[model samples]
Target: MKNKILLVLIAIAAPVFFSGCATDAHYVQTGDKQQIISAGKINSQDFATAANDASRNLLSMDPNPLDKVDRSPAFVVFSKIVNNTDQSVDQDLLTQKIGIALTQSGKAQIKIVDKLGEDYGNIDDFLNDKKTTRRPDFTLSGKIIQTVDRAGRTRRGTYSFQMSLNDPKNRAQVWMFEKEIVKQGTRDAVGF
Candidate 1:
């Protein structure tokens, strides 16, 4: 009955071998410890952290510029945010978080001054048969810069998020903030 014992052992070992080779996937929260980290690129967690820090710093300004406006919710338009990083990045990842925070704070309203905004404004004006005029009191602009350093087999990357709130009318910077995120690991390491 050697063949019978062999079949039994094969059947028992097959499941164990297959299970060991399979990987189970699961959901993970953003910025979780299990998130993947890259030394040469900016990760989503980096964006979130930088945005949160920048938003907090902006909101914590003494004599908050947002409160100085005459309107209940000051109008703010987003200007161009220059990206000096080697990798292509979605700026909305940074601006949207800051926008949501400011909107929820009840201190500012984001106004889209682009062609799309104008098109919607025109459609509303045509439908309502009245022209409404408004101007942004402040402009939000910034830049993202990346710097990298390597020591033997280990690598490090730093991303700097610089932002400024400026009054368009008087040409003055009301508030400015910078947030830097650094990631370090060995060349083959994937997660931090």
Candidate 2:
């Protein structure tokens, strides 16, 4: 009887001991179908999709500000991207993609605000006395909101990405867009 009990204990312990050794790690492309779908966090593809949609629509407006002027590339300034979600996100994922698309489309140039000014901290970069003044035709601002719900074993997370473009000269909103991305998963007994 003691031998029988020891054999059963080993049977149980053997799997547990080796389970921790079977971790699989590999690299995957962004937006790949193999990427883990979590109900608790936002993914990279979410940002890309939102940016693509907003940029596409923004470029389609009739009599768009970008085309009205002789300036081949209209200038723009990126303002705040307010994060109302519980998850902290880097804004560049969205802004950089949109900025690149706009630049590549030959429609706009997003001017980055220079914080160091003409001087460079301990050292200095004020070598050039000449200054070039460029003004942005528009400003971009937006907010991201999250909503989560859990019922029994099922959990869901919804994210809303909102964006708007405003004409700085007239202080009027020129365009607005929002994209909603949802992720759902059922909690398993194994706690994945």
* Residue-by-residue lDDT tens digits, candidate 2, 49-85: 7998889988887878777656768877677688999
What's the TM-score of every candidate structure?
0.77, 0.72
Query: How well does candidate 1 match the true structure in TM-score terms?
Result: 0.77
lDDT of candidate 1 over 145-183, digit per residue (tens): 999999997888989999999776666788988898888
Taking every candidate in turn, the Cα RMSD to the unseen true structure, in Å, is: 6.9, 7.4
The parts of candidate 2 lying over 4 Å away from their true place are 1-23, 113-132, 188-192
The candidate that achieves the highest TM-score relative to the unseen native structure: 1
Instruction: Provide the lDDT at 144 for model 1.
Output: 98
What's the residue-level lDDT of 52 in candidate 1?
96
Cα lDDT computed for each candidate against the true fold: 0.81, 0.74
Which 10-residue window in model 2 sums to the lowest lDDT? Answer: 118-127
lDDT score of model 2?
0.74
